[model samples]
Target: MNEQKIFDNIKHALGEAPRNQFTTEMHLQMIKYADNLKSITAKEFCEGVGLKPSFGTEFSKMRNLTQRLKAAGLNTNQL
Candidate 1:
């Protein structure tokens, strides 16, 4: 994926500046949360994170955000 494009998309979706600091633990926490709530759906995940899930776009967006987080030095499995 185009990392910059994905980052920009997340920034626009969140309506906030990108965070420069995030630890592996934090990434894992979010991943775990997403995993645990199987039925929660990506729509719910976006809602929990304070985003609208009405169009089903947030689901893919959330995945991209997490992937970007991982690329930003957050470990995928270090919770």
Candidate 2:
């Protein structure tokens, strides 16, 4: 492919990146049992799961996903 085409493809791929970057097994657990962790701080969450506090950023994203689910009345609590 041409240089410009390569750049365009890269950009497009970036824009189409997966919506969720929290792909670790712990992250999946966090989503599945979202209610259990929703009320805790990210640091507390990381500590509970033996992860670095720096992972708090990704934990926050998981929280956002659950929050949206709750707001839309899809939470297990709501259902």
Candidate 3:
């Protein structure tokens, strides 16, 4: 998909929730590691994107975000 479309879908999935709100950093990281997400786990994806990899830590959040992305037709298999 196109970059703008991908980004828009991600934003929609992220929503505007206060806690665990999506930030520009995550946005950039998603874009940066878009390709890797299809194959690697979220924890690995986080580390690949320069973030700490936490096992069973905040994994649910990533899974939920990925679900939202999938619902938005984002093809989050990479995520």
Output the number of the lDDT-best candidate: 2
The residue pairs in collision within model 1 are none
User: Can you give the lDDT of residue 51 in candidate 2?
Assistant: 61
TM values, all candidates: 0.33, 0.52, 0.34
Which lDDT tens digits does candidate 2 get at residues 1-79? 3433433433444345466643454455455456655567878666655567887887788767877876876654432
Q: For residues 1-79, write the lDDT of model 1, one tens digit per residue.
A: 3433433444354444345533332333345333344455556555555445553453544455766676798664564
Q: Name the candidate, 1 or 2, with the larger TM-score value.
A: 2
| Model 3 Cα lDDT, one tens digit per residue, 3-49 | 44544554545554344555554653364435534555666544433
Q: Model 3 residue 75 lDDT?
A: 63
In order, the Cα lDDT scores of the candidates are 0.47, 0.58, 0.50
TM-score for model 3? Answer: 0.34
Q: Candidates 2 and 3: which is better by TM-score?
A: 2
Question: For each candidate, C-alpha RMSD in Å?
Answer: 11.3, 14.1, 8.3
Show pairs that collide, candidate 2. none
